[model samples]
Target chain A: MATLGEAKQMILDPAIRDWVLLPIMVVMLLVGVLRHHITVLITGTPKKPQLKAVRESKALMRGSQLRAFRNAIPPHAFASRKAFLTEAYDQGKYLKNPNAPKEGVPAPNPMTDPDMMEGMMEGMKKQVTNMVPQMLIMGWINFFFQGFVVIKLPFPLTLRFKSMLQSGVDTRDMDVTWVSSLSWYFLNLFGLSSVFTLILGDNNGNILYILGLHHYNEPIY
Target chain B: MARLDFEAASLELQQYRQSGERASERVAYLASRIIKDGYSAKLKDDIWPFYEQAVTAALDVGDFRLADECIENLKRRFSSSSRVQRLVGMRYEAEGKLADAQKIYDAILEEDESNILVSKRQIALLKLRGLKSEAISALVTYLDTYYSDAEAWIELCSLYLSVHAYQKAAYCLEELILLQAANPIWHLKYAEIMYTLGDYSLALKQYCRVIDLHEDHLRAMYGIQLCASKILDNGEADGTTEALKELATERILATEVNQCTIDSIKQVVREYLSVA
Candidate 1:
């Protein structure tokens, strides 16, 4: 439907642009840089793989690779390797603990497995570092800049953007191009990835990849 | 003065330095040569890595003063870095203060269990102090964490071989082969290990693999001939096995030294190959 008399051309205050838009974007950018450094700090050194666990995994890798590249070697050589590996597999020779009771033992809890637990702790640390600042900034923007339409999009959007682009502002008939502070935060959250990649190099600790924030896109999209 | 010849040594070490590779012996040579000739101070700022490399190399060659100077420069720049602290630990090691070095290594590991460099240096210290068994166990633990490290696998193999543990060495070589699938050297070593263990068939297979990878490898050709002759002696000869034995003999003789022809082992190989 066309606009009712094409009337609502809400002009946002220049003060909000100065006070809200620039601050939120700058704060988000700084937080992203800080998060990258924090993740680097948390990963103090490259991890040493546990010998038994590495052997266990590498043994499986070797077997699969041998099978895949069996043609690289002579057939008799492949046969010798296949036979040896098959026998080893049957006897569980490469198992971390071949003598462990297999019949009645329940699977090891992830919490109890120190290696897995350490991995989880590292992941948790990174996620917390990523999410905590994000949440705090979001809450801060919601409290301070709620319903304040801070910036206008350069191009026109459909009426469908009214709910998304004006998250905190409860404007019924305002243009969908007017972005309230909270949606601006959302825009900056996803949009600053290229900035982060430039700063932290190509293999960066990007927020979206670490926390899988794309999950948030389903309802919005 | 050839004693003042930093140019040649620097040129020789340029590739290693550019790639951040370790050439300990040559590094030790060039580093000492520079210090002895009093030319380190003249080096450019682009050679900042020279300090780190020189420090380790100086410590290795027992040039404590040079090590101290370089490490002091590094310490001023990166006072609390784990890598620098590791160099400090090696300095302590060079000074015969094994316990002090061990303490640093332990503390480094306590803070960061992933510092396999420290773990490796500690293992080397153990082996240097003649603690063979301890070194083996330490390396075993290191390998568990860094199983894909081909160098660590090679170290483990040599350690096993040092103790004359042929089977264990063979197992380590197997791991090495898997890790470095394209390297002819590991295959050759595995073949030698299998030969030692009297698994001639497996050894013969590995020898053939080495030959396939390295077409003109003298050692692999010799290995193939020996293993094939052994297999044929035990009456396991098929067509391909006989052909491999003959080919190895031909290649070994075709070489510049004409090994078999000169050494009279050619007659023995011919007789061995000619028997049925």
Candidate 2:
């Protein structure tokens, strides 16, 4: 069992704060700002959906609205609408390709579908954009600022956090509150989300944290 | 931002009611210019509503030629669009080719049974052709599918009132009240229906609600007086009813003082006092 002792006061070199802590934070923030602009550039104006798809979706929505608000209309009207929609849905009248195979057939290969391929390409682009900068930042932090205990958090953490908080510093008896430089990078990666949200609106901040976790869990080949 | 400008133009058109012809001409000219200039990439999404309003305004001012041009442009942009097709039907309706208009609407419905715009136009056409029952059924169908449409509910209420279906109209008003409880107009209409149905107590309560929502509503005050007197005549006069009657009279008198319609106010007050 670990016993609580009087707090140990060890001075951190000011150079660690200047070169490692502040630099990591600034770099992360700059990367986030850059990522937001790149995302905006890639997204551009949304392309209009095909008219047939629009009509089909609207038709489905209308059918659902009718089902929900059935009591607002008279019985005769409700009966006619229900019958019409049921027949249409059964016949697949509003389908993009009505002659396509019905239920119980094997699903079409997503690799061969142009729309599916486009979607996959978009996903790949997002993953690449997210992953590359993160890996570079981690590699840079580990190369330049290895094994330095940068700062102590105001709050005490449990022993489980020692491996995480004290990364690149292998001393076993070091307090969990004192984290190494790489852990400080991870802490800033999570903590500066609100500042990013204040700068870039709500949607852009969380993407960086998610990318960080993705790189941590699966090492990029 | 373009939509805001269109709305401002619409408001301006409303304000220039007497010079409607010139205003619509100006609107048509502006719309033509916009269509001619074409939308940049940023403004492409805004073109549809702009053209839609321009076409309607042109139609309103009896400029069939401009309306036709707008429709052609829209059809070129949105080929086989039921909305544009409905506009085509409207042009035929304006040209007094009712059969052709009906055929177009029917064809759109046949192609896309769930086209609510075409359904509404079809109902309006049926009403114009003096097919009241058909219009009512069609409206009921549309309302079932799109019950959130408050304007349609009001239209359905008026249709019922036209056919002397008081209960049905009251039901429509109830739906409207449920949908928009904050809107005093629906409450007033519901109170009016309740008055017609001889439910004086409920009518009085609803009229008081109207007063709560909109102060100094003259019609609701009159409704309160009528309901109070009716309740008194039935010898079911409660304290609340009597207080409501007194409050309504006070509001009416206060309004008369502000508007300087004292003679009419005195006459109404005298009638109410005599009834009491």
Clashing pairs in 1: A49-B145, A50-B144, A51-B144
Error in Å for residue B151 of model 1: 3.3
Candidate 1 lDDT, B197-220, residue by residue in tens: 898888898888887888878888
- Alpha carbon lDDT of residue A121, candidate 2? 79
Model 2 C-alpha lDDT per residue in residues B107-145, reported as the tens digit of each score: 988877767677788888889998888889988877755
lDDT of 1 at B75: 89
The CAPRI-style docking tier of model 1 reads: incorrect
How far off is residue B138 in model 2, in Å? 1.8
Candidate 1 regions with alpha-carbon error over 4 angstroms: A1-13, A30-149, A155-178, A196-211, A214-221, B1-20, B24-54, B57-66, B73-83, B94-115, B129-153, B156-175, B178-182, B193-204, B225-242, B249-276
Question: Candidate 1 lDDT, tens digit per residue, A1-221?
Answer: 24755444566778887999999999998988888887888875657565566678877887887766665544655687899889988998889889877868887778888878878888888778777887799889988987788888999999998877888788787778889888898888888898888777776787455448667444753
Docking class of 2: incorrect
lDDT of 2 by residue, A40-125 (tens): 67753334355466656756776776767665444554687689889988998777678999889999999999878877877677
Can you list each candidate's DockQ? Answer: 0.15, 0.05
What lDDT score is found at residue A81 in candidate 1?
80
